[model samples]
Target: MNAQTVLASSGDEFKAPGPELFEFPPLFAGGPEWLTKPVVFAVFGSLVVVVFFWSAFANPKLVPRGVQNLGEVGYMFVRDQIGRPFLGKNTDQWMPLLMSVFFLIWIWNIFAVVPIIQFPIASHIAFPAVLAASVYFIKIYLGIKHQGPVKYFTNMIPSGLPLPVYFLLVPIEYLSTFILAPFTHAVRLFANMFAGHTILAFFSLVGFWFLFEKPTVAGFSVGIIGVLVTIVMTAFELLIQFLQAFLFTMLAAMYIQSGLHAEH
Candidate 1:
């Protein structure tokens, strides 16, 4: 699913939603080009995360209940599953960043299914790119700071590799670890959200147009099928949204831990 276009035709023929659906019109004529729905949703997504955790943990509680209980569960999931596996004893040092990213991303994706604000902030690419770039730079800076610049790259080479094999492995290692890693990291989440939203919009439109806009006996079954598919995809997308958030944060923790220690 792609989403970036204007209407191709005004004819009665159904026009499948594409990249165009992702594009938002300006709040006012001649407004700043960057001012769009995605940016607004991104900011809102951040606020939601901040407000939620504050409400959950601002005051001391002898026994957690309601939001605190939920927040504790989320915190443990991040610490045990995402942070501890990679950072081990160092997990606490990075919990703030990991929790922020995990919750922010999950909320941003959950927005896709949310009414009134039905857009995943990461679907726009710029948001994920910014987060991934931050992690990439942090990884590099920590690697050089902790291991020394020379040792940072040198440590990447496995000890058992033969002398002759070093030539091929060097470029491959640098390309994969340094360059492709961040690129894929951002794109993985963006692509999943983008595609998932497009799919949802397409089927929802099908159901709406067939059932409400222009109804017919033959079209009724098609509309029902469209509605069923949308329902099924909605459930599947929610699981994916959670998984993508976990995967993104887990990769982030892995990158940080690798930076602090040598690959060898």
Candidate 2:
């Protein structure tokens, strides 16, 4: 049955947010396939990143002002927190890419709490998967280039182990590095976004359903609790979004650094 029939079937019923909450129908509905809310937001997020940096650094101020100052703060945060710790001396070269990744993921995530654009782009698995795959490919390429193909595999597996142990350890190490690394990288960001958005939706829907849709003296207290929970969760989700973005970028840097220097 349709949504109307479902709602109509129940009298004074409240519907909790579920997977259906995340399933946004096409924006165009009947028009182009590519035009959807998530796609638009993703593209908009990218443009915002580019334009923001461009505007920030467009005019070179000696001391810094306005957007330039904020831009510098973000740049230093990524460099000092993520790039330097992971890539060391090479941080300068990778700063642009790292900063872009950090901000893009962050903005995509922050959109979840933004009014009207109440969906986190990273909640979609594909978004994180593509980024993780890109980093994975780069990691493999760097490893092969720095250490020859033969040495790369050798270094990937631990040394000083008994020869017999290779049967068990080598496959584990191989699968962990070559396969599970990327899989986990993507899933970590996606899972956090998906779960965070779901929680926010749940509480928000609770407040709306209990207070606005079918309010009663008995349910008023419950609705207040829902509103309070939504507020609390939104604040918490903000922290998670920033941390997730940092983590994704940090892991990318870690993978690249690992590729540069083989483990003993």
Candidate 3:
């Protein structure tokens, strides 16, 4: 049966998840209108990252213990997988920024599956856009500071291109480096989280509707499949969340590194 027919017959109509899923009303009456679920979750996500790292690193140890060991593992993962590869010898200098971006984005995304906090903050495009913008500005500032503004844009043009080719190549490089880069960076993270959460919600709703809300002979099998799919998607979403965080941080590091050294 079609989704509409199934939903109609199910007694409780199923609401297909979409952007409406991300829009939440205020937490309570008299609260600030902007204090919606995603905003609260975003703030809490930042606090969670800060607190976890602080608690992990607060006490000095000859050998790591408790949270510190776990913290070290995460630190090393981000360093090896993201910072060291891109930043090279300067990796240590940029560890804090890279680590912060990694954990913050990760925790923000992990919130998607957390009980009672099932919203991915990055699914709100503005959040990722702001972060990408921050990196973009930093890239510009660092490039200008190290290479000078004139040299920065000038160096952005590939060196080996013939003089006449500047007509074609300069505009392409300018657009790619200065404009499309940040836009795609933000949208990549936002779109992945947005699509992942929506898929999870849709499957979960299917299971809930077919199994609990309206149980029937034919619908029962569909409900089982829904439950199975939801479980699989949740596991996959967790992997995507981690990968996206790593990728975002890696890109940030690459941008910073590019700013520091002009590409030949």
Please state the error at residue 180 of candidate 3 in Å. Answer: 0.6
Could you give candidate 3's per-residue lDDT for residues 1-264 as a string of tens digits?
655666667666667788888888899998898888888889998998899889899884879998888899999999998888899999999999999999999999999999999889999998999999999898999999999889988988768778999999889888999899999999999999999999999999889878988887667777888899999999999999999998999999999999898854
Model 2 — which ten-residue stretch has the worst lDDT? 1-10
- In candidate 1, stretches whose alpha carbon ends up further than 4 angstroms from where it belongs are 1-11
Candidate 2 segments whose C-alpha is farther than 4 A from its true place:
1-11, 32-34
Tell me the lDDT of candidate 1.
0.89
Instruction: List, residue by residue over 1-264, the lDDT tens digit for candidate 2.
Output: 433343454455556678886676778659776667888999999999999999999896999999999999999999999999999998998888899999999999999988899999999888899999999898999999999999998988877889999999988988998899999999999999999999988888877876888776666666788899999999999999999999999999999899898977
- Tens-digit per-residue lDDT, 13-120, candidate 1: 677899897889876799998888888888988999998899889984989999989889999999999999999999999999999999999999999999998888
* Candidate 2 CA-lDDT value: 0.89
Best by lDDT: 3
Q: Clash number for model 2?
A: 0
lDDT of each: 0.89, 0.89, 0.90
Highest TM-score model number = 3
**Compared to the true structure, candidate 3 yields what TM-score?**
0.94
